[model samples]
Target chain A: MVKLFAISVIRRPIDGPPDGRCVLLKGSYDLASFGFFQRASVKEFMSFSSQTIVERTSPATRQSVKEQEFFCHVYVRVDGLSVVLVSDIDYPSRVAHTLMTKVLDDFSSKFEWRSVGPEALDAYRDLDQTLAKYQNPREADALTRIQTELDETKIIMHNTIEAVLERGEKLDDLVAKSDNLSAQSKMFYKTAKKTNSCCNF
Target chain B: MSVIKKVHLKGIPFNILPETLLLAINMSPIGGDERNGSNFRKKVVIIDENVAELCDKILQNLSNTIDKDDLLDEFDIIPCESKLNQSPVIHDLTSHKVALESWCVPYLFKHSYHQFLWICRKSRKTSSTSSSSSTIQSSNSGPRRDSGNIASAKREKELSRKLSCLSESERISKGLLLSRALIIINPELTLAWNYRRDFFHPSSLEALEKEQRFVSLVMSRKPKCPEGFTYRKWLIKKALQKSLVEPSRIQDFISQEIDMIEQPIRSYSTNYHAWSYRFWLLELVLTYDKTVVSKDQKEIMLDRELQKSNTWIKSNVSDYSGCHYRQKLLDCMLNFCSDGIPLLLKELDENEKRIFIFEGHESLWHHRRTVILLSINHLKKCKDNNGSNAPLSSEEYGGLEALEKTFQDKESDLVQQIESKNYNDTENECSQLNFKLCQAHVKWMERRLKWDLTKSVHLEV
Candidate 1:
């Protein structure tokens, strides 16, 4: 079931205070996963949310959507395949990682092209079930193609895990420092509510 | 013997400890209870040893507030106590003094101190077993007698007071008191019924179980009262919901509710609300049963329901919601009217057109048309099977004639009204439905006439 696919995450910056862009972005992402990305990009970005520019003075803003168009050139290039996605809002990094994971998972499951994580294993299991039910020559050939891609993802996951494991105490120290910072941030939020004021951020 | 000196105690602070110094006082005793003409002298005053000491304290307190010489002229602060052993002044004390206290005991209750003060006169005149018998002595002007009686009296007074303050349990007790009071006053105070409702909340399993018994009690007392009937309706409706998905369980719940409404032991009067609730219960029964019920049983039940609610229906004829329930009861009776068409016609006022559930002023006409059409359908079925020689009797013919007259009258009026009105934009769905029924009834009657004539011709041949 393996198929050749592309996945990436991009950061798009907007000027307004975070009124409602995150909701539109999440909707667009869900639509895109359902193979409705192009339709959603126009409607959500132009009609639903503030991702549109008026009268086409700036060609760059007019290129794609008013929101994603600004990041018009931000794409990830890997194995000669490029993919564009959303970033630059609050939780940009987390959203990017999740989207990348979903896309990678989808590609590995569909085409058997895998790089890291359990995506290859899931694809193999699905293929195994399908083969049991179908028992077609075409499906058998697809499974053989996926097997080749699966090996590549397994090696990538192992390498990533090994690299992270090598970092040891430095990573733990960084995580501990982040926890402390978050605790302080919560205290600041409490103080703001007591003083009847919004968060400074 | 001198007269029993009357005393008044007022404005004692709630926080003060009670002083037993006045428990030993003596006064004149009552002689007998042989009607008004009985020769009973007022007993002579006997200032005992114990009462005298308490009287000295009373004098001291009176002196502290005012001059001692002016005490007899002003309101005298008298100290009274009952003696331990039975004595005559003890009877005198019961006639005059009241045991008033600021603080209350925890549970045992008696009449209010003011009420007891009124009862004191009766207690003194009647008997020596009066509670004041234990502390006062004749002819000894000193404070020396049993202290135990004083302590117990204080305890009894305190207990009665505490009973007054039983906040949580007060409502049920108060409701019972008010119920008894209502029987004495105006028994028609529906507020007493509401007081009973407020006594229970459906918060716990125990409360729900108790609520069942509570409803039974209320209905038992006042079966015709709307409050009890409505509350029972609510309980049955709740039980109906829990058992709604199952038909037999719903039937059982409905039967239980009907029993509460119909067979309340103490009061046997039927309630309109209860009858209407039974109607609603039957509707749900119809929905859930989805199976045919016994015709005889259903008719009997509906007849009883209508008879019970007849007064309410007559008063609330303009109440369309209530009319809707009547319509349902009619429908149930109709189901049982399979054996005899006359029974159905009678239940529906012998006017088929008035049996409909349509809204607005035309509902009577609409309903009448439906009933006529229904009769025509049944008669045509009878004629189709050539059963004119079968069970077709006077009752059936009379039922047929009534249906035909109702249909013809209603149809002529409806047609006339429709012809006069502009039907371009007015989407009278109900009128349209009635028109359909009118057409159906006409066609059925035509067929029935043809069948009946053909059968008669065959008989003549």
Candidate 2:
């Protein structure tokens, strides 16, 4: 029942121009979960998670938010690369972190950190195989097994995005700060907000 | 993983190809091999050209010699000279022939009417000749004629018994039993499926109903198999073609089909096949039975169907298949109702409420678009038919305006609710979701109103 819907590798700028964009390295979504995100572009998905990262003032680097019907686990590596795993709520958090770590390690070894672009991402198409192999959490790799035994305290499970964000931080401010959003997506969010003003009545 | 090896052989008929014969060979695991878990390694042996020719010759000879009566016998494997003069390469050919014979027997028995008549003629001639010889009253040949007469009577009785045993109804029932057993073992067997279709008597309602029940049983067992659904569709068409005498029965059959499909649709959320079949049934009923189902009756049925769909959509908000079927049902409803604009407006209102409850649900939005288009079409048709500037009824216009006002009121209330919630003290996820929902509702209503106004302008033209 704990099916992995999608795994995406996104590259975020560390100290570049304010116009830093999040590029989708490789992503695979199952057909069953196709309905939930059928209209959402990769940029929208990136914006959803990147917005959370921009909002967080605390030292906690990992977050899980219920998006649509699945829990999207966002694990931001030290070098600004993020591995997002979307799975059902029942999916093990430790397994998700381990899978992210393995994928990140494999991705980093195969591609240069500074040279993160479409070409660099294309050089590592084998990551799709890793995504498929790790879909079954029971088939965890060596790191997953070791972490489950030795580092139980490192896993931080947040019930919602708000649980991790500071009190003064608003989701809207974070969304506005996200640089990955396309013009069309921005217009859509604005239109959606305008229509949602019905709540004000 | 153990690798599979393939060997291609030529000059074999497509029906007796490697894939078909491999399926016939029953392979069971011999023992547990600790590494792979099974000791049996599945192998397909492709015989050389010589064996293929020998197989063809053996089959041809068997077909020539084996009559329908010989096939009906329990253990009689037809003997061919090809088998008697077989070489070492074709030693296992006899078993293959036996298997093929048994497999082909049921098909031949069901279809070979010429063989049945041939046996009838043979029995009738023997009986008549013997009876005629005895009536000649020749003293010297009296004993011989009497003996012949007794022999012919016995032969005639045997032949008649065999003929009754292979009667059409009996053969069909036997075929049904065999196919049911065969399908249970391997539901993908197209040959078995095709063979079963030969037994369906189109005019017999009872036979058609039984076939429906059997297919339902099959679908319940193997929900993913398309063959069962196809067979069910064929049965429904046959039933419809025959239901001209009592057209009400078609309605009953359709209702039963809907009831049957509800389980599969609920169990598997996006079963496109079941949804397609439901659409087909509705189209058949609405279009095919105009004389049988009166206008009033069709309206009532459509209303009931609409209510049923409303319940389905309420429970299954994300299932696009259900939403698509609901749109089709609405299209059918528009055919019966003269004032469809109000109905469409009401549906649009309901869809907005649903989108508010379940934000970012794309199917609901799609359904709203469909409703808008249907309303526009209805308005155009009404103007064309009535030749009036104001195509819509005054009451319908009043209903649309009232619905628009209600949407505005809901939007404002949602905004007030969001504004009143304390940002810091509230549960972040709940408040954020509510905010997003409110935004989505407002956006959808804005588009809905714009489309409605555009269509209303079209009505003026």
In terms of DockQ, which candidate is strongest? 2
lDDT of 2 at B275: 88
Which segments of model 1 are wrong by more than 4 Å?
A1-201, B1-217, B241-247, B263-271, B287-328, B332-342, B346-461
Summarize candidate 1's per-residue lDDT along B271-377 as a digit string, tens digits. 34555666666665554534634434444556666665444333222334344555565555545454545554564563332322221333344444445555556
* Top candidate when judged by lDDT against the true structure: 2
For candidate 1, write residues A133-190 as lDDT tens digits.
Answer: 3211222333434443332221111111112222343423433443223432322222
- lDDT score for candidate 2 against the true structure: 0.53
Worst 10 residues of 2 chain B by lDDT: B73-82
Per-residue lDDT of model 2, residues B1-461, tens digit only: 22211111234433354543333322312244433311112222223233334443433433322221122111121111111222211111222211122222222222232223333343344455678664343343335336767644554464456455675556555445545544532356565677666544656765566556555544543454567678778777776666633776666667778787775565456678888888887777777647777666666667878899887777466678888888888887766665555666678777766654444455665676567667665655655655354335635445444544544454455445444552442444434555555455445545755423222121111
Q: Model 1, B382: alpha-carbon shift in Å?
A: 16
- lDDT accuracy of residue B311 in candidate 1: 40
